[model samples]
Target: MKSGLTVRSDNYADVLDALNKLSGTDVLVGIPAGPPREDSPLSNAEIGYLQSTGATVEIDGEIVTLPPRPFLDMGIEDSRDKTTARLKLAAQAALEGNSGMAEQHLEAAGQIARD
Candidate 1:
């Protein structure tokens, strides 16, 4: 299937969670150009996760060099939590016989699950 995907990095946690679900795909992650802000700089673990995925990373249009190996022990518990919630919503939609909504919720849950 052919499709387009776009995700904003406004919520770093969500972005990280979504990244967990990707497999064998090239991704471009862009960071705004300017003085790094304390609140916006990516954490070591996040960077490690992206490095593990081999995604192309750019900061202010400049390509970033990634380390050869990902740092150890990056957990995705937040993704599991979000996936559980979405699964529940999907179940509720199914009970209401709203197949389309159920499908949407399940799709979201799948993304969170990285399935």
Candidate 2:
């Protein structure tokens, strides 16, 4: 006397798709590209990195020092709460198979990073 039960359900394809879309995305934060700095040849990104970490160089035969301003970190910290909330919503939407909402939330998080 043995009994077996079978459960039937549609595979959670939407959830899978959302998970794929949200994962492995590279988020960039900080200044966008622009014309080269008048005094420095470094690109905006390079300048940002130098400012974030601090650097020194000689210009016009005079030494200049860059302090660790950490603006990138500061901006992230400023948006930390809102970004995290969006990320959480994205995750929850993905788990619930709400792919569209998940993607929207993910995009909002990206916007937070950009701004």
Candidate 3:
């Protein structure tokens, strides 16, 4: 179990990295947390870096659900919200047989799990 504040700073990126390195496999990305904010905007380099490691990015954070399934680059309101959405999306993608995408989203979620 994770506390609300703890979840806020959940090292999602490290988690993804570990998961990738351990499994040596790719996964789909999802943003169950939502989308990235201005301060923490998703960058091509970041996305590319994750992709290079065999992962797909998705912005399924809980904040903005309008886009349904968005990419990490898409701008959103709060980092926490976006992070949550991405995490959820990543979980969904992984459960749906998209490990690459799941990993990507999980990475982003971990990134957002910061202070």
Best by TM-score: 2
Clashes of 1: 0
TM-score of each: 0.34, 0.75, 0.31
Clashes of each: 0, 0, 45
TM-score of 1: 0.34
Model-by-model lDDT, in order?
Answer: 0.55, 0.82, 0.55
| lDDT of model 2, residue 7 | 46
lDDT of 2: 0.82
Model 3 lDDT on a 0 to 1 scale: 0.55
Write the residue-wise lDDT of candidate 2 on 1-115 in tens digits: 6568564765589778877776855555678878788877878878888889998978789999988898888888989999999999988998877878987888888799668
Off by over 4 Å in 2: 1-11, 33-39
- In candidate 1, stretches whose alpha carbon ends up further than 4 angstroms from where it belongs are 1-76
| Model 2 poorest 10 in a row by lDDT | 2-11
- Please give, for residues 1-115, the per-residue lDDT of candidate 1 as tens digits: 6567675435555434433433222222222235434775876556556777666678888998765553222233446688778767766665554556666776777565443
Please provide, for model 3 over 27-93, each residue's C-alpha lDDT reduced to its tens digit, 9 standing for 90 to 100.
3343334455466576555544454444434465544223223334343324668777986787666
RMSD values for the candidates in order, in angstroms, are 16.5, 3.3, 19.2
lDDT of 1 at 28: 26
* Clash pairs, model 2 backbone: none
